[model samples]
Target: MVKLLFLLVAISFVLLFSLTDFSGESPKHGESMMSVHLPDFRLIPTTGASGPESFVFDISGDGPYTGLSDGRIVKWLANDSRWIDFAVTTSTREGCEGPHEHQRTEHVCGRPLGLAFDKSTGDLYIADAYMGLLKVGPEGGLATRELDEPLRFTNSLDIDPRTGVVYFTDSSSVYQRRNYIGAMMSGDKTGRLMKYDPNTKQVTTLLSNLAFANGVVLSQNGDYILVVETATCRILRYWLNDTSSTTTPESRGNYEFFAERLPGFPDNIKRSPRGGYWVGLNTKHSKLTKFAMSNAWLGRAALGLPVDWMKVHSYWVKYKGNGMAVRLSEGSGVISEVFEGKNGNKWMSISEVEEKDATLWVGSVNTPFAGMYKI
Candidate 1:
């Protein structure tokens, strides 16, 4: 009996060691401040709306059109100071009434994410997490689904100003937005960067097998595209002038590494009028979480655990309610400035940043209000 007990103890020790290989190193906290200052902010409340992940203006520059949790694309009317319903991505409205319904019925209600405007046509393009890429006319109502065949998680997008061609990212081919946490822990590399031509309706794969491809933005001259791989914490650039076309899934375009070892997982990137780009850091990276993710078996086991318990173990959850944004110089990829939220006024999970009229408009996926800060 003693020998049997000793064997069991040894087995337990080995299993525990395998499951709990946490790196003692901690993730670097963002630098407190440098050249950027936290501007004065006011929250624009979206009545019964949640998760305004992105924002775009019409050709007239009259709106900050955004998609809410209830699958409705709404426009903030400056005259009225309220959000008016503009378009619906999904026709089925059953059980899609409240702000939190998306947590349960996203597949049914549609969770629209990225929003971009075709400046020439005055049409709005949407990246719905569940319904795929969609377009709505300037006079919005029901959005027309453009591409749904090869997408699982349609995350963010940008449209070329001159050609009107749309570029977007599929966060994961294996996991939907609802299971995003699972996709992150699983080390999903099936994400992709794709382009859609409105004229031909042809969808072309620009790059594939990305590590959770998240944001996409076209260069100022439209010569190249920048895509963020959130899982690897890196940015990749794909040259549009490359005439060579390869059909491989791993390598699809003339791609080059742009930025890596980011302090946080970048969510969305937008062009800044100051000859640079604004990147929103969803949350600061955690070394413990990175260590946990290195082991697939441990990640799978953690998924089986209770969600409340899992939240405690998540790095994002540990650093919730903190905000960080970085400004990178154009082409050079130099860190120009950093913007952080003030104490007691944290802007949690900022997914999009838009600069207009000397003010920065910030949108969050987990907050009820959109923030506006004058620079």
Candidate 2:
């Protein structure tokens, strides 16, 4: 009994000491932790109205763009903050229910992850984790599924105006969004980067075997597609029009690494209207924690322990810096420093946030207030 007591004390001391070293390393260049301040937008329930997940600004200089959890899309008037439901992601009428099916019923809403405006069609393309890739009319009406069997775990989507093609990523082909942590614990590469042709109605795999493919975007020139490998703290580029590279075999697709190592695991990537790309880091990268997460054997063992037992040995990771946006083209894609969470600033789970016109609206997974920001 005395030996067990001494062992517990020793373990606790070591664990506490280790946590002291787990501070945020550094903010990306030219970035500082700022408080987020947002407007007070009344939270409207989805049963009677649309459940907005994020917000975007109108490209035509009209107003704010809001995305809903029930799969409905809306346009918000910034002057008054009044919202009008424009499109619904799913027509189930039953709404989103259960882990397997996430469609909208009268009472619930389907999960709509990412939203983007296409310059060519002037329409909205959304990536629904369960329902696949969807497009809403310019006027924001009913949503139509473009790809039937979109890779599971579809998170973000971006369009190249030049090629008229859409690019997106699946975080894990083997796991649903709810089970991604388990997928990472398995150390399996089920993630993939995919492209869809609007004309042919065909979706092709551009890259595969990613650790956790998360966000995707097109270069300013539309020459390459950049995707985020979240679990691995890396970003990959798929060349669209490059003629010089023969490093990749035909079977594996002609994609090559555009950028490999990022400061953190990027979530949703967006091309800034001003310049550069904005990437949301799921969580601040921790060298010690990541080393353990990367080892499936060790992770499984730790996770298998009892809840209380695990708690005794567990370490809590608080992300000092919530997330940030970066410019890859300039200076070989130097990312901005981490954006701290505060008033008027953006928060995590930004894929759920909407960006239209100049306002950036985001809904939180576990936050006191949902976001309504002017970018």
Candidate 3:
């Protein structure tokens, strides 16, 4: 008991003090930058399933549609006051039914991670972990597989409205969602940031050898896109076109940090209605994570131990009924913030959070329901 308490207290200090940035750059948003009140999330239950990892709205702004652990994509119907089935994944989900299917049948049932909708075509594109890229029409049904080659762990995505091209991430070839803890700590670098061109029906890889690529979001005007590297706690920017006078095609917009040294490890990123972007911080960015990311041997040693790395990592961070998220400007400055977990509803570990019509819609990979907090 004494050892457990010591571990908790030591990690708390690490979480508190790690945000001090020494480099004279733009102001980074850490735990210290938060100044808003914690939001009390109103639960939106998924009936009997969990892990709605991504939230996306249609062009008409009718949905915050999400995919579930049970190989189903569902949308919230506000007028009917319930969630309705929108689409099913490409994997054959013959035995995929019940809560927390991720523990056993995620691969068999086709676990969908990221979702986006094309404004021009009204088509919903999905990045299913087991079945690669898939899409459904405006009238939802069984999703059609988009890619010929399989992706091991397709994570998140966003659509460019003007061009109708899709940007997505392949998390890792070595690790699937069933053992994400291994991917996070094993120093695996098999991830990629890719795009699918609808006109050509071709998928192209823009960036390769990414470390745990998790979320992908195009900039507000589609100048460039940002992809979150979860293991490194930083977001990378890759330009699609040479807008700047100094940049050339050969440069490839290499090694640009959109945001770095984040307070928490990011999951999904989305555009804010007001300005800037909203990032879903899945867990605290502790010193162990920072050191482990830099030193491969330390990461492997920690994972090699007999201890359950998932539980140790979980206990190393705090929920404590204090959920939080951040809004960042294009310059990486904190514009607005929200943090709360009231009434036994713990949303501290978020998969994605987006603001539309003054409400914060939240998704988590570990929860049975999505959450809503009105401003």
- What's each prediction's TM-score? 0.84, 0.73, 0.83
TM-score of 1: 0.84
lDDT of 2 by residue, 8-76 (tens): 644643564366343334655565443455343334333333334444554575645655544556665
Q: Which of the two, 1 or 2, has more TM-score?
A: 1
* Tens-digit lDDT string for candidate 1 (1-375): 755655554454345534543222133355224223344577888788687888888989888888888888999898989889999997898889774546678788999999999999888899999899999998998888996576899999999989889999999988998788788777779999999998988999888998899989998988888899988877887888876323445444587776776767788998898878888877655544455546665555555544533343234433444556777778766566676665555565667788888877888787777888877
lDDT tens digits, residues 1-375, model 3?
756655664555346435523121222444324333344447888876887888888988998899998888999999998999889885476678764435588788888889988899899999998888899999999999887877889988888889889999999999987778889878889999999988898899999888899999998877888999988877888877756323434344553677777777788888888777888878654444455556776556555445565555455334321234667777654445544343454454788887889988888887788888786
For every candidate, C-alpha RMSD to the true structure in Å: 5.7, 6.3, 5.7
Pitting candidate 2 against candidate 3, the one with the higher lDDT is 3
Order of models, best lDDT first: 1, 3, 2
Instruction: Show model 1 residue runs off by greater than 4 Å.
Output: 1-39, 243-253, 293-297, 304-319
TM-score of 2: 0.73
Name the candidate that leads on lDDT: 1
RMSD of 1: 5.7
How displaced is residue 95 in candidate 1, in Å?
1.8
- Give stretches of model 2 more than 4 Å off: 1-22, 28-55, 95-109, 244-256, 302-331, 342-375
In angstroms, give how far residue 210 of model 3 lies from its true place.
Answer: 1.0
Error of 2 at 195 (Å): 1.2
**Candidate 3: where is the Cα deviation over 4 Å?**
1-40, 243-255, 305-323, 333-346
